[model samples]
Target: MTDNIWTYLMVGITFAIYLGIAIWSRAGSTKDFYVAGGGVSPLANGMATAADWMSAASFLSMAGLISFSGFIGSQYLMGWTGGYVLLALLLAPYLRKFGKFTVPDFIGERYYSQTARVIAVFCALFISFTYVVGQMKGVGVAFARFLEVKFEVGVGIGIVIVLFYTVLGGMKGITYTQVAQYCVLIFAYLVPAIFLSLFATGNPIPQLGLGGQVTDGAWLLDKLDTIHTDLGFKAYTSADVNTVDMFFVTAALMLGTAGLPHVIVRFFTVPRVKDARLSAGYALVFIAILYTTAPAISVFAKTNLISALQDKEYADVPQWFTNWEHTGLLGFEDKNNDGKIQYYNDKNPDMDAVAASNGWKGNELTIDQDIIVLANPEISQLPAWVIALVVAGGLAAALSTAAGLLLVISTSISHDLLKKWLKPNISEKKELLAARLAITVAVIVGGIAGINPPGFVAEVVAFAFGLAAASFFPAIVLGIFSTRVNKEGALAGMLVGIVFTATYILCFSVFKMGGPEDYWFGISPKGIGTLGMIFNLVVTLVVTYLTPAPPVKVQEMVESIRYPKGAGAAQEH
Candidate 1:
């Protein structure tokens, strides 16, 4: 079959399965809507958690980032992986034992203040919306190329599909659908990676292939380094970023992963605290399968991309190039009217002589990094079915996380804002309706944001992680571990952390207030969250000492969650 036919078949079949699961598992009550009736098995929840955790950023953009940024991109791999370990060990079990429907729910009750709850709600909404924008962008990119539609139109389609399942089934539908999505995305990711690995290094395992020799008997990484330096770019194995910034970015991502409300909420669906722990373990295994292979895929794709396209004739370019060009994500301008492509770092001083000698006016090829993974299969001349499968996987990764984030947004409004704070006596049916309505609005807003995102998928996601790290990490950690952290402390800390981080990101990234010289203490906006998190911790500690301690009941509640009986009972209070 043609690529279009295979894409439609795979996408249609997978989407049909998702919709079927949604209908089958649709929530009938507030409890079901919020936590899938709180009876999910550990294995199933683990799969769902894996799917939820691996968003568009993980499946689509991580490899692409590594392909271009070289060793500096290891920060993403290390931070996110370390962050998941932090979440599994430090946060998941305790939060599950606390038996809350959402992160805000835990903060509100644990701190004994509706004011604290409201602050957490705002933080959750802000962080989730920022994160979902990245997922929406991923969806648009996939659909635009494979489905042959405008990027905006692809986002619209994604919004509709996510809205259908998310609104109809709520957490119940999303959970089971994510389990299926895990299978699709993992399979999609591994198939192409394995193919490329075997073709590149005669090894079936991508991880092994990364270190194996290429056809010409040179180490793969060495060849990549030669290619990179030849093109006037840094060696693929070298780190160009400073150590402090790398540490801060890695720390922010780690803390952010632990504090992400959507991933945290997945534990609530399970039946017991032990189940939560088990699911966390299972999720780590599932997640590692993709995470470990990412660098290898990065190496393979980068080598293939450079070998195929660098300095190639524009007219004689491969079919994939023309296909991607029509989508507007890939372009070649005949700079110097040479009718040839130049893909290199033109700004590099060392390359100036090379460019002049070669009669290259300037680098004339434009390639969006987000397209690398999606276009990898095509660039490597994989079969049509593999390409189609990748499109489905990209959509699966995007939609699963989008559903999870939108659910967090809706739950914050409907549960935290309306039911818990504004109208404590609201009916369950009405609250469920409110949740659906809230998600509908969030989907539209997210779709609009996706159309014109502030940055690429990974960059935008890094910002969201920064926000989560600065705002939620401190509050949750203090609320659980420290008995003296009062509502005033938690509230003040979250407000300050989020405000400072958001302002820095806005100034540097969004507004372009100054160049790299203006970075505060040599920290970029992406890494400033580490500083904000420190500020939050310091403020929380100081405020706790200055103000009265949390009430005796709240302190006891914290103690109870920390040391629950029988691997912690999972029944909600």
Candidate 2:
């Protein structure tokens, strides 16, 4: 390890600043805790939302997935960022105008039934729980490496710090802290990317460097394409993935981003509907900065990785080789005793001869794709501080997302489920206390789940988006636009839609329910969630038409939510 005292000091100072802000901004009322008293400026809220939305998976894991998946990975980049567009066009402004404290509140009232609200609350809790697990796990990994602590210890430290401010400041504390986090994460993500770009391609801009020409006068993408094809791998910039699945995956992600309970709650912090719209635009711009750079980073890293290992002997490899090998990340087996690790697509029949002749044992480099982005700084020989910053950025992404998810979970339990349903007469202080307790429990469960993450973090995350799209997005949109949808229709929609969506995902993903050979037209888990969304929309519409219209009073409530001025007071009461 590099004996860089200053890097540790800087990291320490950053953490201290975050703690101080959280304490200073602690919320004083239910309003403060839930929506920061609806006083946030559009720009500030936009920045905070960006921080909340761009989690550890985005910062630390996405580029790595891209690096390994090649052209197939662009779907993630496009799906995630493009989802913002759908949010802007379809959901954000109208939901902000509704002026509710929580998603379940809208669901309950819009459907004119407590049952709908309770189901909405359960949906929010489940989605938040699943998503937060990944974020907390990310925190453990980053802290373990950077702070030199055991993974569980690091998770405990993180849980304590998050609980302190989250309980104290509520939405108020989390919002401002998220602003700081946004800066830290963006700086952390971009600096290493810039350095790597400059080092490998002599280019300053990562986006251009990805496709730029190298010293050998070949375009980077062209070279990657050549290598991948030569090794029986698909082209780096082109893939053979199904177009329909791609379309739905992209659509589901976009709709899901718009529909996520925690993200939507942030828009409520803005003062008006106009601010909500403007804030979505700003959030997209903030997110786009990283999204645009990420693919470039992926391309560069993959190209660099292959070139570094092409003909190098095992013993001659750098210290990183041994270090990663110890972690079970890098493996080498010389099949023919050539003493050189040959990296090729083992699945490619054309490369089998090369593997046999060159003594390459089925391309033995087993480094998990998730490690690729974090490994970039080291690969490019960036300074120790840059590497340290990467650690901080990973933490920021994980923690910020975890904070947002916990808030959603707490609010749904305390405000929507308990205060609204179980104990309508509960005092504000008790509600606040309950919220805190819920948050603590949420953190503990999330941390435990993090220890044994299900599937790759990014792929599993796609399920949350799909769930939101199928269940919440349709209800919210129909609630806002069509005043006639009754409680029965919505309830039927959510249940049927969720069931179909879940069944579809489980079918292809876990149960082999579809069969050993068939896959509903080859819809993989990564893209099947999109199909689930479509099923939800259709089920919801069909049920709504068949059911009786909502009572006139419920129609009036929908009308009231369309305008910002009158609905706020009623929601507060």
Maximum-lDDT candidate: 1
Over 4 Å off in model 1, which ranges? Answer: 566-573
lDDT of 2 by residue, 1-573 (tens): 572464576578778877888889988888888888888888989899999989978987788888888777777888788887877767777777777888899898778789999989987887788788778767766665555556667677777777777777899889999999999989988998898788768999988888778888988889888998988888877868777767777777777776789898998887878788888888889999998999888887887788777778877987656555544435787755677767778888888777666666687666666556666676666788887788778878888888999999999999998888999999999999999999999998888877666655676677778778878888898899888777777787777766777777666665655652476675665666567667767777888888889888888877776754632421442
lDDT of each: 0.91, 0.79
Q: Which whole-number lDDT from 0 to 100 does residue 503 have in model 1? A: 97
Q: 309, model 1: CA deviation in Å?
A: 1.1
| Model 1, backbone clash pairs (residues 3+ apart or across chains), number | 0
Query: Per-residue lDDT of 377-481 in model 1, one digit per residue for the tens?
Result: 999999999999999999999999999999999999999999988998898888989999999999999899988888889889999899999999989998889
